[model samples]
Target: MIPIYFCHRELLGLLFKSQIVLTDPSEPPLKTVHKFMQKQLTSNVSKPLSSDVIIKSNTGIFFVETTEKLEPSPLAVCAVESASQTYPDRTIYFFMKGLTKNMTITKSSFYKAIPLLSSMENVNILPLDLEEVVQDTPLYPWYQKVNPAKEQYWKHVSSDGFRLAVIWKYGGIYMDTDIVSLKPVQEINFLAVQDYQIVNSAILGFQKHHQFLWDCMEDFVKNYRGGIWGHQGPGLVTRMIERHCGMTVFKGTEDIICRDFSILNTQRFYPVPYQTWERYFQVWNPKDSFNNSYALHLWNFMNKNNKRVIIGSNSVVENLFMKRCPRTYELIIKHASRK
Candidate 1:
């Protein structure tokens, strides 16, 4: 009786408060008291505070900078699809600057190849209009003035500017369409190193209205040299890091935490160097699983003329497609059969 009273104080209190006086030693049965205590416990803390619970949300954005809206290549399909799969919970957006028509996941060409991408309700396709992105962006006026003589030059320089502007306005992520995501990007603000000496602007993540992004936009205008290759792209990003973080050359590991922002090593994005871009699509060691890499950049520009992802080839790219984007792999296999 003593132990029961100590264990169930509320029950004892209720029994004591009752008007009925228990003169008999066998007044309250232990079993009856246990049942009453159970009822009291259930009554006290049953319902949960439904509204007080907080839900976590994150947004990621990717862009395709092309002039015409052709069917998305398998690699391009893999890039967006893998990103969507890796971060299923996060809001994933794909921006096509050249596309005039808006497309839903159901209507998109890549949807047939990767059904998982279509199921991702969080994924959105948006048109990348310079006028829309540049309006509120700090470097709009500067972007208007730069006019490259050649179309190819414009494609490179304009994309460099657009990436910065859109990211500044939206504040999520800006990944080049060639990047195939392997895992969830954890850092809110990060830049990936292309090599030990250079940082690539191909992948950038930031919170909305990050001041560092604003500074990068400003620097793009001040150091506008569209003719020279990489001057406005990787070179600009490296220069900005040097100015702010005091990093002359980004010598870091898979993850580097700086005072201003975090930096990921070259292996995270560019596991296969530009010089050895073909090796990525070739038969390599099956054991070499790029464990440290979060994503792999196919370096489309470098391999544009030579390297192609064959359907039957047991190459690294094909293997990646099988494991990461299986539906896409099946689609490619069917296409190969038809061919």
Candidate 2:
């Protein structure tokens, strides 16, 4: 039996004293009571109170920013806020590599958004210590030997490595900051398909200590390429998928089970391909329902012109913000109105 430590003696007494009548004859009384206690404990401690009062059942949704930028982009903040709203029961963790423990919030508009992001009960804004995250993983040796200054694409390479390390360390979903969450993901272990032949690492879900993630980490270290763009990101995942499940094209939205893990169809995350990312910025006539899609990847990397989402534009992106992330939308409108 897993030992549960209680800080308050009164709370412990109240637990045992509470009437927990089990209707199912098949289930052991003790087991039923234990589950009830666990549920009670989880609901009571929604926010991080103490180390002992941890929410083990609540799945983790992680978003990492490898660059030393304390103030996250508006889209990144929207992604986090949307996820938090979608998964109120689950914990949404936003790790900023540049955020320090003692850092103060400045008066800048960007910095002010941090407090609003943190205001959500389920959202946790934490510091990302790369070295510490990769310590026990297979990527540790590679990370130690790698010189970020020498690497041409260190930002992309480091972000790729950090995403893998964090997911491996704590079993949950890892998504790029650019991607916004639309709904709760049901798959416990799966990878998002970017296209017919490639799988994108923008979003991934797996249990803690999964072999596929470990293999990916090992492959990441073995094939360690800092100079080649997408070599460590999508390229690494695509190669790993081919090795695990062999080359196969998904025809529909149905999930293809690749041994222990599953490969989700492109429509689930990438309904709008990167090639047509402009569709997000353009106004849709009929508007897309995207019933099958769990989330939308704005392809922020592909926005060369760096078009901002206008409140009255009625673009797909603006509508998404208004409906999916109201807090962020309000912030945008508030900032725009001030100017």
Candidate 3:
């Protein structure tokens, strides 16, 4: 049974007392009430972090979660664990916009996974304050004025903006939570190709204050479209690539070098296209070696039904988790056995 922390009357009273500005009259009242409650809950549950805690530039692996869920999905846990294990020398920072300072085993649904991720010396699970992260970047002004609740694709738009801002502030690899790291990234500055013409922003690597990233941020605000999907993410990156690197199609598996950064081939990150996302969930005969890949993007977005990773499924995804993120794999097996 779900827990009810507040009655409808109290909720109404709280909503009336709060200072949340609903810019769009068409916006649902329920969403505004929910946001107010979330803000109140976050404030009550966690204290702010000290200013001394800092993320170093050029030597970090980043993963951002824009949702308010305290418990990360199993795939997200695996993504962080695999990156932590692969890059032991470099720091792995998992920034959750909803994360609070006091979220611990007793309070979070990710009790088992949280402790496991925290045990890694190189892993740092931190809070992601959108305003603070985009402070000095081009997105700052837009972020301040934009009413996220009014945007149709606010989640994706915010994530797209946050990645560029964070990467610009402190250089490193910015990978989506669905990407499982298999090897250390060799390129100093790079973007992964999603298809022949599109360069995906799911996995990016750059140095601090890279001009390419700055230009991307500028374009993000100039061409902002909350209603259009991918307009701020892959589309923005692809446009920037066309401007900087020219229109180059991927014919072979070789990396294309621009002025300062390189555009990696599709095999390096997205070995399986989104159209074939089920290939990851299905059992393979010989099993894929993924020899040419550095990491596999699971395309979790394509899993619309939210399929469970069965223990004995022996699917490609199961195998990847078993090998790349053994600890998370074990947890999955353990939970399934209990069920």
Worst 10 residues of 3 by lDDT: 7-16
lDDT by residue (216-238, candidate 3, tens digit) is 99999899887888999999999
User: Please, what are the lDDT tens digits per residue for candidate 1 over residues 70-117?
Assistant: 356677777777777787766565545543321222222343432333
RMSD of each: 18.4, 10.9, 10.0
Give TM per candidate. Answer: 0.75, 0.82, 0.82
- Candidate 2 regions exceeding 4 Å error are 1-58, 106-110
lDDT of 1 at 150: 52
lDDT of 2 by residue, 1-339 (tens): 111122221221111112222334343222111233445543344322322133242277888888898668888988988898888888777767776533444334355456777667776665666776677889889988988899988878888988787777667888888887888888899998898888899999888778898999999988887788899999999999989888656566677889888889998999999999999988855659888889999999999998878868889888888988899989755576678
Return the TM-score for candidate 2, rounded to 2 decimals.
Answer: 0.82
Clashing residue pairs, backbone N/CA/C < 3 A, model 3: none
lDDT top scorer: 3
